[model samples]
Target: MNKAALILALVAAPALAEPDAHALERLVKQDCGSCHGLTLKGGLGPDIRAQALAHYEAAALQAVILDGVPGTPMPPWRPLLTDEEAAWIAEYLLDGDRE
Candidate 1:
């Protein structure tokens, strides 16, 4: 393959690796739970249960996860999480499928 073709192929390739559900779940339960409450009801941060977050679109939730609420104790997670991971977490939270 020519260099240009190789470059294009690489750039066009989708990131095939799905985010680790187990790890993300753990992160949500542990890291997020630390502030959102063990049951994600309410605490120092605020209630993050699915019902409480029904007003939010998944993308908005993902953005909050990636960038955090400025001036709040919520810390940006972009450095530690990929966009895909953040999306997964958003869906997970919205789905209210926590254990």
Candidate 2:
């Protein structure tokens, strides 16, 4: 391949790669679970069950997941997650399919 093509391929590799579900789940179960409870029922943080999140918009929740609540233990995860990953986690939380 040409030099420019190789550089382009390298730049696009991450964007083209599939997201790792196990990693995402682990993040939720370990990192998020630390505060939200292993089952996400509630702990240091409020309950994140689907029913409890019924009133919250997915975008709003995604914002919280990425930016976190100021002055709270919820630290922003933007440094650790992409916006798409944050949105996925928000959807997962609202789906109530913890496992």
Candidate 3:
């Protein structure tokens, strides 16, 4: 390939890459954001951005993400999210905690 074509391909490579986190965020917005806000600030569900520190542990968050809490609007996700996906979300919450 020509140098210009190669550079173009490289610049466009990231767009072709599968973004799991972006996909997860889309899913969260679709599934979770009916309650939680788009930014996780708050809605029908408690504010994940503002309150995650007090309400969650990495493990507990993973559990809630994967299996969900009973008797809450939260639904069990055993049929949906894999354990790794749940862990990723928990880590995202921990690392991105707003307060």
Q: What TM-score do all the candidates reach, one by one?
A: 0.82, 0.81, 0.68
**Cα lDDT of model 3 by residue, 2-58, tens digit:** 999999979976764543788776787667778888877779887776356556778
Model 3 C-alpha RMSD vs. true structure (Å) is 9.2
- Pairs of residues clashing in candidate 3: none
Local distance difference test values of all predictions, in order: 0.90, 0.88, 0.74
Per-residue alpha-carbon lDDT of model 1 for 7-28, expressed as tens digits? Answer: 9868865652578898999999
Candidate scoring better on TM-score of 1 and 3: 1
Rank the models by lDDT, top first: 1, 2, 3
**What digit string (tens of lDDT, one per residue) describes model 2 on residues 1-99?**
899999998998797466567789899989998998988889999888899999989999999999999999999999988788888888888888645
Query: RMSD, model 2, all Cα superposed?
Result: 4.6
Ten contiguous residues with the weakest lDDT in model 2: 13-22
